[model samples]
Target chain A: VGPGDDAAVLSTGADEQLVVTTDVLIEGTHFPSGSRSDLIGYRAIAVNLSDIAAMGAEPRFLTVALTLDQIDDEWVKGFAKGIAFCASKYGVKIVGGNIARGALSLAVTAIGVVPTGQCLLRSTARIDDDIYVTGTIGAASAAVKDGVKVPPLELNELWSRRVDDMSCRYFMPLPRVQMGVALRGLASAAIDISDGLMADLGHLTRSSGVGAEIELDRVPVWKSMDAEIAIEASDDYELLFTAPAKEAERIAEMAVRIGTDITCIGKVTAGESVAVNGEVGRIDSPKGYRHF
Target chain B: VGPGDDAAVLSTGADEQLVVTTDVLIEGTHFPSGSRSDLIGYRAIAVNLSDIAAMGAEPRFLTVALTLDQIDDEWVKGFAKGIAFCASKYGVKIVGGNIARGALSLAVTAIGVVPTGQCLLRSTARIDDDIYVTGTIGAASAAVKDGVKVPPLELNELWSRRVDDMSCRYFMPLPRVQMGVALRGLASAAIDISDGLMADLGHLTRSSGVGAEIELDRVPVWKSMDAEIAIEASDDYELLFTAPAKEAERIAEMAVRIGTDITCIGKVTAGESVAVNGEVGRIDSPKGYRHF
Candidate 1:
């Protein structure tokens, strides 16, 4: 039974566990004026997919709840196409959802599956475990800061290309699902960097009942970004995970196989505070986006 | 194992099938101005629960994605309390969700479980099956229509009581989970009556590749509601189902056991059109809420 049915049924293997997460993107807030509807739909699903990946689960299904203030045929068509494109790339099926009238916004609840006892948890990071972050950070945040502005039509080709690249980064974030699934058995604890790299690391340390020491010099930040800004900029949907020191080589090998850079920039320690560069400086959100 | 993790994990029994559905409630649309924040939270989850019940599934878990334009401490507290209360009532847990800054809206994805291969599907109604509806329709629709107007403080006691009752019905819907689960093996096809009685019946007939003849005189309507109005009013949140004529007695018994009324108002036939009161009348929406 499909759309006409009141609910969708999924048959799960006895030993498999279902992983669920949800995220929302709003028009005026998340996607400012002149934003593409396609990117809005894509980002809405990507953020939730990042959460599922953080748990080292295989993406399986999704339900999208969309609300629109006004019905524009073109906009709706573009949004649906974007959703279908992103869902196909992630191999997730659109199961069930509701559409309603309101401010333009989308909420996606993504379901994933993992073998029992194989889910990576944020509360399992052990002390002395090396903390690693995958891919470069701060590019998406920088893009969002600079991409929304409309440039002059007569702008130089080089500048136009630069703007286009930045906008693309801002619009489509690559959820590191492959690397997350690969770290299933190796990672002690993991969290996605949706709330800035350092803030999410803080969340992991708090959940694990420990602290972390981050080396600013070793952090992989986007070019021209300040280390401090990179640590506070949200929208880097990369994985930050903790693993034992002995698995560093295995982690590197997995990253190589996945074709993404993974850097060990910190270590878990005793206590319940996060220290950046040997100082007791906590990750602060000076200009970062806060969900609530 | 729960909130602190990236996603929630649900362990299903070997033979259990998972049923999923999602719904959204927007402030300006679903609840108009002057609606209570607590009820907003309650209805957000209740509507999704109704979807699960429509499929004869036991409600299990939910993920709520909330976006708010502005932060109000009291509103947020009441909303959370309402969610907690509703979750407790349905024995469903708040598993995973996201909170963001945007238009005030809530999207909840509910997960339920049913026995494998036994889900009451919408496309399974056989020709000549008697069609039935659970509970009175039009109360919720009427309440939403009338309750949005602010009542004068000097109103009489009797009128105040009437308004209060109507508004309560609009705010709090009782999902017929018990009746749905009980009708699992008895009902050939089932659908929730959220998009009005006639519209939903049309959906059922289309999916089943059959037609229905509804006797308007036999349809149950709320006090003071016209038969036509009741059939076209949205937000009834009741169940419309089909079963063989021989099972009418059993359906009535189940309804009595669940403390709700079940009315046999129609019958399925081999055709492709819905006829009301022996007339080929299709339900048309004049001012009904449309999502798209």
Candidate 2:
């Protein structure tokens, strides 16, 4: 009976509380209409969860803002299924979501609470840290190119084997949940690869007040990707991380224990710059999703 | 530490939830750039609170999704101030929000959890119940013609005193929180004034699987407004509710106690149609806020 009361009282008893972040996925900009509803829903939650993962926090809940062209019942059903599948996979719950008509868009606000001071941020990288990335990169970029049949939006056979590749990476970038938790205290700084490797790494350096020298030769590339494609391809939902070189073996060990791959790509430098050793002519500029 | 983990978790604690509702506000359709940022923000939250009131739920925590054309810090700040004022006025907290670039729309998913089963909804109305409305209706519609002055986007007295009736209703609507809370157990079916009296009442009727015969003569009309303006006019944030005649009197008392005014609009009838007698025709043929 307190709908219009003076104030509202919310109950949340966690002391080390609230991992909050927002991400927007728009039509034409993020995904096209012909895209699978499952992929759309999966990525919607996955990207937001990546933000939570970057904080080294376990994502437990999500609030979805879905703006639609019209309530395509079948599409909504598939979208909901994708969201639920992701939630079930992560053990997260969709406590709330809004349904309204607008340009096809979805904005998700994810919240999680971790133990106090345990949350990781991009600002923790230090000079001389070994730069590493989880899983493969550039496959997503290549999938967008000619002759690359990116599994029919749905998880078909083509999508299964290379599910970890960049194209699938675009739809379902597995947030490094296991490695994130395992590398919590070990890794110096971490970020999910949404933008290009150079770009997201730049964020880590900028936030940590340091520069990085990424060794193009040391970068982990996939069998399908060539040298040039590896340099500029983006949407690799892997973790591009910086840790002390001394922890290189440990990082690899942790990745093994977590059942994921870790590859050393470069090292954190003392100065201010993200230099690609030989990739894409040393990406001196910031190439990422700019919200303007 | 599960960056790529399944999901992040936020605690809702042991408090009984109060209010929960989802409303999407679109750009170009809802408000223009010429509209004041303060009013936009205020109306955004206010309209949402109106939903909470309809459910007879307390206004508490809010989550905002700002899909922008460009990231305008000043515009956002002004918009936030407007919503912040409403939240502060009602003691609701701005828990979190997301910012992303889109075609320019905003969606707010607000939550207020009260004692379970105490919330009011449109499905609870019964026949022979009294119909009531909170505050004046159609002022917002007339403001379109009268050029309703609104509260200043910034601190300007000229805009403050010179009221734009239509704009105020369109921009800022008072969700009758106190009244809504008071009518909790008494009122049957309830809804906030968004689409217009006739239209919203239809939702309540349809939900309750009943019909209504609103007394056209009994409908509340502003002194400056005639029946013509009243029928089609929208954006009145008043609460239209149905209840037993005796309990309807209590709703009236609650409105008075809150220092606001309300009127007995109509009655719940048998069969599924909303009419305003011969003097007034059916309003809202297109309905409210149909986005493509």
Fnat of candidate 2, please? Answer: 0.32
> What's model 1's lDDT at B267?
90
Lowest-sum lDDT 10-residue window in model 1 chain B: B150-159
Model 2 C-alpha lDDT per residue in residues A1-292, reported as the tens digit of each score? 2212222223344355556665668887677657778778987887777777776777766767688888999999989988887877788877667667778888776666566667677878999888888877787667656323456545444236546544565677677777776777888878887776766776778778888877777777766566545756666677877778787787777787779988888888887867665745665534442221
Candidate 2 chain A has its poorest 10 consecutive residues by lDDT at: A1-10
Worst 10 residues of 1 chain A by lDDT: A150-159
Query: What's the DockQ of model 1?
Result: 0.71
lDDT of 2 by residue, B133-246 (tens): 877777776765665566454523322432344455666666788887787788887888777777677677877878777666666776567765585567777888888987
Alpha carbon lDDT at B86, candidate 1: 76
Off by over 4 Å in 1: A148-165, A278-292, B148-164, B278-292
Worst 10 residues of 2 chain B by lDDT: B1-10
Task: Give a tens-digit lDDT track for model 1, residues B1-292.
Answer: 6765778998888898999987888877777755666767877888888899989999999988788778888888878877777788789999886778987888888999999987888889999999999888898888877864433322123223432366556656778888889999999999988889988887888889888888887898888788888998888788999999999888888888888788999899887767777234544222332221
